[model samples]
Structures are given as C-alpha cells and as structure tokens.
Target: MQQTKEQYNTGTATAKQPSHEADQSKTQRLRDKKVGDLMVNKRRLVEVPYTATLAHTMNALVANKVLAVPVAAPPGQWIGAGGSMIVEADKQTGTVRKHYIGLATMLDILAHIAGTEDQLMDEGVNDGFDLDQKMSVPVSTIIGQCLEGLSLWTLNPNTSIVDCMEVFSKGIHRALVPVDSHMDNVAGVELVESASSYRMLTQMDVLKFLKEHASSGSELDGILSRTVSDLGVVTERVFAITDRTKVIDAIKCMRIALLNAVPIVRSSDADNEEDHKQLVNGFGREVIGTFSATDLRGCHFATLKTWLPMSALDYTETVFANPLLASIASNTAGPTSRELVVCQSDTPLGQVIDKVVTKQVHRVWVVDQQGLLKGLISLTDIIRVTRFAIVAEPNP
Candidate 1:
C-alpha cells in the first residue's frame, strides 16, 4: 500500500504489535524500501539554471520555502566533443554541459552577501557599486567569484534508503541523484547523454518517510536502538560564540564556518573554590541559547545597510540600545531563546528524533551532566542513520 502524509501523521497505517518478533518484521519491511521510492523525481523538482542571477535564485528559494535547489546546465547545452557530457565546466568558458554541476543553497547565498558587505565597506564609494546594484549581481558571478572552490555531493538513484540515511546523518542537508545516463560510440569516441532523470533527497523527505513507516513505538525502537555516538559522525571541532557576542560577528562566524546555526554559550569559573583562578570554556561552558539561520531571515537588507558602517562593538551596542533592533538581531535568540531543545551525549537517537520532530526544531544540543555543551544533533544527523539502515544488509 502507498503511504500518504496524512496516514503517517495520524498513525492510521501503523498497527499495534503484539510481540518483539512482529516489530522486527515490520522494521525489516521498512528497510526493504528503496531511496528511489521516496525521492522527488527530477521532472517535478524545482531547479535553477547555471545562468540565473543571485536575485533569481533567492526568489525561487524563498517562494518555494526550500533551503536549496539543484543547479543544472542550460537546456540543450552540450559538453565534450561529439556530445560527450561533462558534469560542470568553468562558467566563464563557453563549454556546454549536460548534467548538474552543483547546488546553490541559501547558506551559500547568505555567505556571498556577507562577504560582499566587507568589499563594499573596504572600497567605499570607489567600489563604483551601490547597495541596490550589488544586490543585483549575477549568481553566476557569485558562484564563480565567491564560491569557486566548493563542490556538491551526488548520489545514485538505486542507492538503498538505508544508505541515504547514513549520508544525511553526517549533517548534510541534501543530495542530488543524477539522471541515468549511457555512453554512446560516435566515430570511435565515447559520448554521454542523459536518460533525462534525477531527483533530490532532503531532510524533510526523510522525516516524512520515518513518520510514515516508524509510527508505532516498537517500530521506532528498532531504528532508535542505535546511539548517535555510535554513528561516529559528530564534527571534530565545535565552534560557538559567547552570549555577549555581536550579532554581526556571529553571522560572520557562521558564514566562515558554513554552518546554518551555532550554539550560544557563556564562560564561567568552576565552582571549586580551590581552582578559582582557572577558567572553564569549550565543553565546560554553559549553553544559553541557539542562534540559527532562521533568525537571519528576519533581518532585512535595510538592517544590514544601516549596520554596515559601524564597527563590530558599535553594532552590538546599537542593537542593544534599540528594542526594535534588538528584536531583529540575528544572534539575540529572540523570543524562543530560552526554550532550547537539548540532549546528552549519551542520549538515544530516538529521543533526539522525537524531540526534533515534535518540537519542530532543526537541531538539538548535546550537553553533559553539568549542562555544559558537548556536541550537536540536527535533523540531518538523525536522517543519516535512517538512510544507512535502509541500505545496510540485514544480519542473517
């Protein structure tokens, strides 16, 4: 039977399992589902052409409420001699390509805009470009000039759902599955052309699939038994900012780190009276709140325009001085600041998923017994495990 969103959310399709054996059988069925079954086919997918401007890309993402979109070669553009296809060629060169070259994400756009702000200030009026004109810069220029070194990860269509989950668990937001293609012999040279197929898999898709298939408690248990630490995918380095950090500086840190969100922490001395002079930071610091990409969405270009002229410290003071500005500051944590969704490093993966889905939040902080920050678990992280389970061979 086909699964529907309503059936999943309402748990109408999940049956009460009478025994552990029956629960295992149901989980096996879920593992058998293929990634192709859940993927959004290319024809129905939204994409941006290689030649689109940054403005056009931003409009598409905002209008669709999507975080990113696949960037494809212009229609009918052919690459390689005799129509042999190349995935991505330098945009400056008039080389035609047949496949998707990269992905343009909201984060990428934000970083580009942030980077441009520095250039505008450094060059002053001599830069010869005003605020409105800079905003109109072509996406091609930004991708080529600003993000020349980045690459997008691609996946195969036949990849098992379990394997896909592993990928998402790595904190990656999306993956592109290229259309099936074949090599053709033209005059003794191999040329490639599309079977005209592809799809995009995202965290949202994984969440939907989990909601549909793992609705029952027993079914959820089968998947959630695996601990997050067991995945061995936590980032090696954690970056955070103090609670008093300037909002603009925090944005710059995220842009540099290429992170959608960052943990907000505060440093304090340990309670041990004998070690009064010692300062405990890093994993020992307290996590006060979380600042995320969503917060930046509330900031207008006008806010950026007004704040660009000031120093970082001045920017912080100005934002704090005005209640209206404080509310819109990208790093202030705003209204929901105190309601951070957090878990321990040893917390079960299922609990994390439950909190994230039920709370409708993107990430959960991994804290220690003392409530000090340890790590993070985002939807992308949990989704990875689900994708991996679908692809992994079951034990005999």
Candidate 2:
C-alpha cells in the first residue's frame, strides 16, 4: 500500500538547472532535449545474428528479459527481408557497421505458435500443428507479425522529445534510436547511417521520464496532478475475471480481446462491487491478481502439445480445474510473472505513471479504496495525457 504524500514536491528541481536554462518553459525545455537524452546510461543494443533461429532468438530475449530486439546483419550485407515487418532497407541507400534486419519479440513467437496447424480443438480430432518444425525456422520471419498496427520507427539522435511523444501517441510502441549514425536522404527519408550502435526507446522510457519530471512544475504538472478520474483514464468498460476462473478460459478471453493482460478479483458478489455504468467511486474493491499474455511465454513449444488443445474451440475439461491464482506461485520467477498493483480513482495521474513504470506493467487496475476493480489506466492512457498536456498544450 502506498501512503499518499501530503503534497507533491513540485517546482523544486527547476532552481538546480543551469542559469541559462532556468527560465525555459516546459515546451522549450522539451524541445531542447533530443530523443538521445532518453538513451543516457542505457545499455548498447542487444541483437541476434541475422541468421538466428526462433529458438536462439527466444533464448537471447529471455536471457536479456527484453520483449523485442533488432536483428543485426553483418557489415555490407543488405538483409533480404521478404516477410519481415520492420525492414525498410533499400540496397542503394544506407551502409552501416552492422545492418539491422528487423525487430523480433516474444509475442511474435507466441503468435506464430498459436497458429500452429490443428492448434484449435477439432471436436476430438487428434491431428495437430507441428510445433517442432515451426520452432526450427528463422526468427526474422516472425518478429513483427503481432505488431501490424504499429509502425516500426527509426529515429535519429537529434529528433526532439516532442516529436517522439507524437510518435508513441500514434500507437508506435518503440523506436530504434541510432547512435553515431549518418545517412543520405533519399525519397524523403534518411536512407542510411553509420549506426553500428543503437538504443531502443519505448513508451516505458517516456513514462519514466515523465514520472520523474512532470510533478516538478514541468509542463504537465497541472494535468498529472489532477485525480485520475479528472483525466478520464479510469476506463469503465474493462474486462475482468474472478480468481476462480479457469486458467485456460482466462487466457482465451484475453487472447480474443487482444488484451495484454486482465485483472483478477476475489469477490463473486456483483452487488458489493462498483457499477460499470455510473463510474462512481466505491469501496470494497477486491483485485487479487492479474493474468497477462506474457505469462504464456514460459510455455515451450513442446509443452504446448498439451497447452494448445485447451485453447481450441472445444477445450479440454480437465484443465478447467486449474485456477489462475493457484498457478501464480509457480510462475512468479518466470518471464511472465507480474505483481498485483492497484490504485483508487482519486490517485494522482503522476502516481499511476510511477506504478505502471516501476512495476513494468502496461495497465494498472483502478480499485476503490477497498481494493476491487473499477476501471484501468493503461500506458496508452498515460501517453495520451502526455500528448495533450505537453505536446499539444499552449505555452505559458
């Protein structure tokens, strides 16, 4: 439980800046900072060879605990990116010490596995997809299948934070920030850069930056200081499940909804909970856990022999006995495990940003003071606020 601070420590850090920058407005200060500022103290890029298999790439991502990575091609090699989602390479254009093949992720791997032949229940027919052959293919083919809605953006060090916010707000989850890169402009885009080094900046990075600076009388302090309800981010149309819900059933629900995660509750009684219609504050909230798409990352292809059938149109009855919370214990140490985090409607928007970033989650369930679910605050919501408050706000 986080104890509410008596007051936000706002407007204190401004005095510490250099005298020349002391009088800058929030917009000017943001414009002065570049995308590269987010890369400060960040590790150099983590990459896999262009020829890496899906299994090898998955191992690299698990070891690094990263969700996505840029596939690297050897120097002077133009990657043949036929099925790739992020490859924007044109042979006559850019050169680099190491060329980027494309970005790959755990979700892409999962999405591929989900489509395995006979992955659906065929009313007891036994023919199934060959998970082994599927795992043996090159990983680059699968990297961006799940991110069709997002544009894979490549940004230079000099691009402003204001521009980056607009990018993320438009549904691009991450950007590849090239370091020490140079390229020629062709067809309205920079064709190449000497970018052997790269850093991936994500929505989390921006959220962390805002969490640290927004309340210090930064441009967004006014909006961030408002209660979450005031910001209209406490969405009421959220889908949730009970602690007793079967694990397989829960996963299917989220998968169908295309949700990264769903909130879990302990209370079965509807009368005691907040109304989905009114959006009013109430007590006795009982959010006990969360089930995320990431949790299934631990399911190896071999293990999916049993896991996939239960996900079919006619799921297995036996697996229904496995409760979601009961399974959480074994997963706490895995890549998919997450903590149960909740907040009230009146919680400051800045505080929600802190929780979402610090907890490494995309959404934070908004509970009544008593800890049951009412609505949710997702990274998209927070980013939308940042877009309106900082990127679109008028200067003082």
Which whole-number lDDT from 0 to 100 does residue 206 have in model 2? Answer: 81
Model 2 C-alpha RMSD vs. true structure (Å) is 8.2
Model 1 segments more than 4 A misplaced:
1-26, 40-43, 75-99, 116-129, 144-149, 153-156, 169-172, 178-198, 215-237, 267-282, 306-338, 358-362, 379-396
Give per-residue CA lDDT, model 1, range 330-362, as digits (tens). 233333435568887666677776676665567
* Candidate-wise lDDT, in order: 0.55, 0.59
Per-residue lDDT of model 2, residues 226-312, tens digit only? 899988877776776554454445554544555666666554465566432122222244666676655554344455667543422
Total clashing pairs in model 1: 13
Candidate 2 is scored at a TM of 0.69
Give me the overall lDDT of model 1: 0.55
Task: For residue 13, give model 2's deviation from the true position in Å.
Answer: 14
